[model samples]
Target: MRILRFRAFTRPGDPTSGNPAGVVLDAESLSDADMLGIAADLGFSETAFLSAIEPDAARVRYFTPRAEIAFCGHATIASGVALAREGAGSTVAFTTNAGVVPVAVSPERATLTAVETSVEPLGGVLLAELLDALRLETTDLDPMLPPAFIRGGNPHPLVPVAAGVLGRLDHDADAVLRLQDRKGWDGTIPVVHRISADRFASRNPFPRGGIREDPATGSAAAGLGAYLRQHGLVTMPAEVTVEQGAETGRPSSILVSIPPEGRIRVTGSAETL
Candidate 1:
């Protein structure tokens, strides 16, 4: 089994943007447990294992250190790029825990159209608990955008905060675990700015998955697009870009599209290392 690690959303070695993803080849031979172990060994926020069901279609699954997630955007971009190198075309689709995600690969970039996404109302008790785990105050949120539960393939509590705080995300790992299990949530991020009136700035804390921070998160960004739409944060219909990882030195970005109807589209580019 071969594993490929790459930078996504933003350039590698550039602080303050992008996602670092692990790509696995010949994953058809590996079992689910084997895949999970591989993710643990790689130590990336997400690792993708490809099991081909068709030449143009494959069953793709994502694994974090802690468990299998429904989908992962960065890994999808990395995989699409790898496949294209092997003669895979620009248009492609991957079956994931989230659903069938369509991907478009360009000469120097790959964009993944996320499965259906939506925003759920936040449960006050659970939100408070997560905030407590991170030692955040309600005032930290951007008064402009209220918090909501954003669901792409995974669920994330969208905490709209100030851009300055995006670089100051800190939290208790144990408490995050407790909150994740207690609230049945997968991950959480405190957001501040929308890159454009449509885009956003965010920092994700994924202690539940054993990740202190996620440099670039496409799935979460996709979810955010839906959450923003639901809350009327962006009354105008538009595609948005998300910038992350700057505070930690691995700058990343995610481009998302939201239509009045249908699933949100998340796009990003990845490079092999």
Candidate 2:
């Protein structure tokens, strides 16, 4: 029943930033209730439970304080580093509820190739509802990156905000929860602003997970990469950096690599806490 904690997506030499996640190395005997209780007690946004299925493969499950999630990027990164530290080798395959994710671990960082990604335009009615919940106006949106439902592992509504509007993102918890329930969304709603061709700032609200916001969201970043590629916003085989958690004072940087065609790669460093 040992629980390990790690801060994922942290910058070099600084462990104070990034998102904290819990990892249970041997979770084969733990029931769903036990995992849920552990996640709730840990109070991290997400925790990963791993059961080794082979020397370099394992079945991983993710849980938040409120419910189980199909996939979690930060927790996966943390688990990868943790497993590597435990002599699991440099590469490990994690079979999550979403799909099989392969991670390449190093002493300094870990890179995870996410499952297949897809993006589709969001309906105007749903977009309006989402804007109302986030206390944002249509004018605040970036005309270039329209609202879309992006899925890397889990699905989230990507709302691209205009410059200077990202810092002012505020959402009603109750309203967001209601929308999430109605829409059957398990992930956060990300409001992003482009800083440059390859850089962006983002804030993700996770009312469905009983969290106000996520400091660094790797899954959302992967989805964003797919969206950018699908919309011809970025050139093929490009790398994008997403800066997040500034509003919460736990600034984190998530790097995503988009290939010409295939799974997106999300890379970050993690430190044990």
The TM-score measured for candidate 1 stands at: 0.91
For residue 226, what is the lDDT in candidate 1? 82
Candidate 2 Cα outliers beyond 4 Å, as residue runs: none
lDDT tens digits, residue span 11-96, model 1: 64554345777888778889878998999998888888887745477788888888888888788888888777767766878988
Alpha-carbon error at 226 in model 2, in Å? Answer: 0.4
Q: lDDT per model, in order?
A: 0.76, 0.90
What is the C-alpha local distance difference test score of candidate 2?
0.90
* TM-score against native, each model: 0.91, 0.98
lDDT of 2 by residue, 140-228 (tens): 99988889999988899999999889877779989999999888899888899999999999999998887899989989999999999
